[model samples]
Target: MKITQTRDIRAANRWEIMHQVLEHSPISRVEICRRTGLNKATVSTIVKEWIDKGLLAETELGKSGGGRKPILLQPLHQAGAAVALEIDISQVQAILTDLSGERVLAREQFPTLGESFPQVYHKVCQALDKLLAEMPPSPYGLVGIGVAVHGVVDLSGMIRFIPRLGWRNIDLRSLLEERYHVPVSLDNDGNLAALAQQNLEQASLGPEGQGSEALPQSLAVVNVGDSISTGLITNGEVFRGFHGFANAIGHHTINLDEPVQCSCGKYGCWEQYCSNGAVIAYANTVLPQPISTLEELITLIRHQDPLARQVMDRFLTYLAVGLTNIIFIFDCQAIAISSELLSALPYYLPEVMRKMVLPITHVEKVVLSRLGKSGAILGAASQAVFQFFQDTAHAMEPGQ
Candidate 1:
């Protein structure tokens, strides 16, 4: 009867819905229908399948409808729990997020400097224990942990070099695995930032949304801090050039001023013009007194210090000159900014766009990251999960 026909339509609709839900769960069937343009009967059928498969659980019971109650669906932690760890020179931050990237608990932050590798590792374990104590048990359990830090980490988890952290060739992956007894993933901080933004919003960079799909996918993740770099994502992956030397735009030779030396043993790398270090350097020259941080400059700007104003304008101009080539080359639909710099995007974003040679319509596409540091941790976590999934997918064959 009508029930059988409803099921058929719903079955097909559910498949479509699940694909979308895999990326964005915790949504109501109503939103799913609007997103996929399907009827309620179809949504219900698919939701039931997801519910039966244990991939979803009921989060809320809405008011009684025309017949039955409305239930809000959330993706179960089927893909399992993931631990995201960011190792900074000054602090370490960790978070545990479900498959859908919803942080299930409060993040744990710890000091990083002067601690032995074993000591720092154990503190992370203790933090995980504290977070899991209040949660209900799940089926998939903890699948993996992702760690991101400054430096070169080979696929093997060896930290080749981290100048800021003052570490060289440390065996980080093996050490973490020994303690956590879970799969560990390590990536550069910039790469993780790009992954975080990708999950938050689809880039209009490609043809399906903004331009031609035939073009190679691309990303520019500008992170401003004590250390800075842009992580490039291309063709649905991080474009680590032969030997992983891509996206080091921070050292692209953007300046030639004297007494300006980059850590890479060069004069006027892009970092000298667009990084926090650059701002601080300029603030000292312009103002009667040197400013310690970007926050101090912001405050100075508010007080109408002519020095702050000039420095801000100069930063914007340099950033513009650096990114214009990005648009021409990557044809990037979005240029994501992360870390503490995101909060200041509203102030300097327009100026950054104005400096571009392109039209206002094109420049208006400058995209700021939706998630801040949260993206960094989650990006690492997602990397671990995807790596696991790929391995699993490869191991299973259709005939087998």
Candidate 2:
């Protein structure tokens, strides 16, 4: 038991050291020790082991502190790579990124409209094959694959349902692991987007001494596209709830009098009123030419068309209502919205804020997502990279 405990402690130390290096590369071992609260001896030993293992590389000298310049350490980011995929109703997009989440190859995508599950699976496999073929030489090769699905994904990586695609009970993780021979992570697209946004905000905080304000401990990411979904971060971690179905905020009933039924067979779901499809559907009713895409409605609004503006105002109002409800339930310090329509017309953000009236909830805390459409894709890659490090740390156990 003592031996096992010692090994676990060592493995945790190694993870801590590696995490510091990965997040703030070109850092000195002394700084790592300070940041991780590990002794100089332990930090030095682990750093030496990783350097010898080709996981870390000593780079040029850092600034001197009234002494010899300290050698900086950086992760060999290309030592491994991860594949991230976003499977949406209309499209499937994939990207291969290094351990640091830097894109190693151009993005690949294929439309999935009306495609069967088997067909989509085959195309996803083909996309992965193409990416692997183009991957640069690496020590660890492909470390893992992360998938973002537009549906309810349980903690065990089982996709429970995807209303848009009519998919149910798919074990995507096992299938990918069987074929790729690597760790596989499957999660809801909204949850992954929230993870990505959180990482971005944390990264922006910079090194320890930059004096940037700390990120909000609680945050929410709302992804409004074909449908509306929400990712919640509570106390600085993704809140998956009991069944990992916490992201189904879109299905929440917002209007009791709504005559039109939502895809989930509900009346006046939050998504039915706030999603991009909802905006387009409403626009087609009043516009003479019947816009099929959100872009068309946005263009009409940009041109100051009265009908388009009316539709947009209604959309924003409904959006605010849902957001107000979210704030009431979660009390998040901030809310980030991921929507192409919102990102394109940022001026409307204030209008959304204006419509939301709650004394306890500060509407000003609501903001547009900086990651935008790439949130889920990058988040998926980030998840894989994180899992890679965790697995690597666990491999430090004795006899394995």
Best by lDDT: 2
* lDDT at residue 153 of model 1 (Cα atoms): 61
TM per prediction: 0.73, 0.95
Encode model 1's per-residue lDDT on 1-400: one tens digit a residue.
Answer: 3535543444445555764555555567876787788888968876776677566677876555477776667667654677778876567888877755455555788887767666776887787776556434676667677887755665556776665555777877887788768788888777788877766555333312334433225667776665666677777677666766455566777666657567666787776777776678878989898778888888887787887888888887877877886666566756777636436546777777778787543532566677765666778977766554434333332232
Model 1 CA lDDT for position 281: 80
lDDT of 1: 0.67
Candidates' lDDT values, in order? Answer: 0.67, 0.87
Q: How accurate locally is residue 181 in candidate 2, as Cα lDDT from 0 to 100? A: 98
Candidate 1, TM-score vs. the true structure? 0.73
Residue lDDT tens for model 2, 80-183: 89999999878999999988875656578999988889999999999999999888899999999999988788888899988778888999899999999999
Clashing pairs in 1: 207-211
* Candidate 2 Cα lDDT to native: 0.87
> What are the clash counts of all predictions, listed in order?
1, 0
Best by TM-score: 2
Flag regions of model 1 displaced more than 4 Å. 1-19, 26-53, 57-74, 113-136, 155-157, 203-217, 339-342, 357-364, 385-400
